[model samples]
Target: MLWLDLEGAVNVRDVGGIPTDDGEKIARGRLLRSDNLQNLSPTDINFLVENVRLSTVVDLRSPAEVTSEGPAPLTRIDRVLHVNHSLLPEHGFAATAEALLVRRKREEERYPGDPSCAHYLGYVEHRPDSIVAALRAVNRSAGAALVHCAAGKDRTGVVVAFALTVAGARREDIIRDYAATGERLDRILDRLRRSPTYAGSIDSVPEDHHRPRAETMEAFLEQVDKRHGGVLSVLGGNGFTDDEFDALHRKLRR
Candidate 1:
């Protein structure tokens, strides 16, 4: 995981150099993941546009959040293709307490062992269309595709994990990349805490809830395997054809 030194965003990293099971590695500059682009500075924009050659951005934020936060800095960049693929419902963030309670109930019903694992599974179960859209946007990118959500740990993690899995990345490598976010959780949380869109919700959550545990990702992969027979099956079942899968694999793998 190569962390990008962006002035505004924390928990940003290039999801490259990850070894696949067949000996190939994910190409650098092809896929990147970050927290949010709402606060990206001009210099940060130039770096991503010029140096990283980022041409696509897959935003996983909900419609309500987007409306509240307004357009991100990347929206002004004509060359960048912005795709909104919200994995949750439009009114998902209506009431914080109600939402949390509903989520906890669903998580408990889905996976009795880990709440995070259940939450991640819900990403695929609830919104296969959005997941398909995100992967398609990534596959169609002319250059690097930067995928982000508010925290870049859950929605982003699930999408990136599916991408890596479909591209033949090693399971451990994917888990390591997902778990890497924990190292910068404080900075990521701090950035979110400063944003009005996320401040209230984040403040009500426990500190430990922010940490990305390796086991959570491990169990997520297991759930994917057990429930959908693996990433390929999940994608195919979600309307991703063979050609689309091939295109995504070729774009990410070296």
Candidate 2:
């Protein structure tokens, strides 16, 4: 159970090896985090399907996002669950990306810490049905599961955070997982380029659209701490069950 350094995958990490408060570590390779798979190389796809034995791929993007950028087709995997949730504002990814990019141009303007970043996490907090749906799929999957979204840092990050928390992972480990997105930026953007939306004009999207940085991801995670005390509250408040928590811990802790 190690995180595979796939040639074209961004932010791909084994959600394991972080010490919890009780001194346990997350089981490696049982869970993985990554950006969209729209441009997965055939080799990469084969590795996940044939070698990793991935049983599920939970997509957190909205319907428009998925339709605009179709993901890589999966094989005999049990299911490809689609859970629609807007990490950005109501209009969708394009609008939010542009706003973030504009903010980036102004002095002292930074992502992750910006007010917009809070709105992104707010949506996740107030409305977690989409996130829960993805987790439920993971619960039902037969083997390893890979979860992703565009850049895999915000929406995907939050969901992965909740998953880790449910599995009793440490906050520091969760932060490290979010921070890994920065290391895989180029690999993610390369895949973004293959999307039809990736070719749109700058006016239509943000300059930082393709790059999901660690700083921004950290800001989002910080907001989760500031707002709900932790991911557990977010899930509990939103409707997750104690049984689900126990089940997730059992399934992921090894």
Candidate 3:
């Protein structure tokens, strides 16, 4: 993962150049992952739109977040397709993204195992419809597809990991890509702390608890393999086929 040095989002990166198990590397400027894009500056916008040629913004935040955060700069761009598809549960406004993260941690701490892995799996198990929709959004893109959630760790991580696995990237590479977010943990936490929607929830949790470990992602992948027969099976069970995944691979590859 090649990190994008943007002024607004701290966790933005191009998930290209990753080697597939087939000995080919994923293409650049095609598949990018990011954090909250609500704070992108004019220069940042210009760079993404002009330089990166970002064509779709796949927001995984809930409708409440889209409203509470107000209109982002990317939402107004007529040329870019903004797929504000939220994988978040439809329970109500009370379940903010950060709150769920902390809750997952608490649940994990209560037991000796990682409940957060279940939370990640929930995206595939409980929210397969939403997952299919998001993948379709990526598949339909005419240019670069940028996927993002709040911190671009859990939700974004799982989605990207699944896509890479489907696209033939190696298992260790996928885990490393997820753990790469930790390299920007300080900046990511700072970006979250400055936001009203997340500040309160994140402040209550220890920063050490926020770190994205390789084991956590590996655990999630293992669960997918053991229970669901791997990533493609998860996608296939969700109605996404080899053809659909190939379309996404083409959009992501050179």
Candidate 4:
């Protein structure tokens, strides 16, 4: 079930069964990606924790977002571990005037044609530790690990892309997985619009501006390859050892 139909989450999807680089495929029930889970119905929680065997949630929301959004439904679940490793700059949305200017220039320099691509790069550029920690959490989960952000597009996409790269997934499949979120973009945006913490940002931009395009992820992976020797290199450079990677490979491969 790549695109899950949930009452609360508009962009829930399983990140399994995709083809790897050498023709092997990702195993089912190992990973999932999704939008915010603040309002997940009881049934939705049951399906994930029971059917999916989701044991850990790698939340990529910043401290401010976590504070703003409050506790999620999974917080009460005894066996589900919650890990927070925010992939945003320290100041984040509350950056000073000078910081905003510097970030704007960096965004322009990274990918002038698409601010979204620039934002994706900023995840690794700003907080490589968070990305690494999120992967570690995923690898360490007792059962399935689910990664998510508010929209499950940029931050979640970057982290999942790195994990897929480590798992030897095909590049095209990686890009396709990121772009697949576009099929639910309208609902994603609508869900965010009702969120007190995220609505302002969602409404400030036109709906089309939030649409996930294949080129955006394509460019991100290209830039990652050009600048960081690709996602595997990024993981290795960040202290995620080859041994750790082998374990992830074994866990994810069919």
- Top TM-score hit: 1
Candidate 1's TM-score: 0.96
True-vs-predicted CA distance for residue 110, candidate 4, Å: 2.6
**Candidate 1 residue lDDT tens string, 82-120:** 999998854565426556767777777899878888888
TM-score on alpha carbons, each prediction: 0.96, 0.78, 0.92, 0.94
Clashes of each: 0, 0, 0, 0
Candidate ordering by TM-score (highest first): 1, 4, 3, 2
| Ten-residue region with minimum lDDT total, candidate 4 | 92-101
**lDDT for each candidate structure:** 0.89, 0.66, 0.83, 0.88
**So what's the TM-score on candidate 3?**
0.92
Candidate 2 displacement at residue 75 in angstroms: 6.1
Tens-digit per-residue lDDT, 91-138, candidate 3: 533445566666676546533476657678767766777777888888
For 34-103, candidate 4 gives per-residue lDDT tens digits of 9999989999999999999999999999888889889999989999999999998887554244554566
Quick one: best lDDT, which candidate?
1
Between candidates 2 and 3, the one scoring higher on TM-score is 3
- Backbone clash pairs for candidate 3 read none
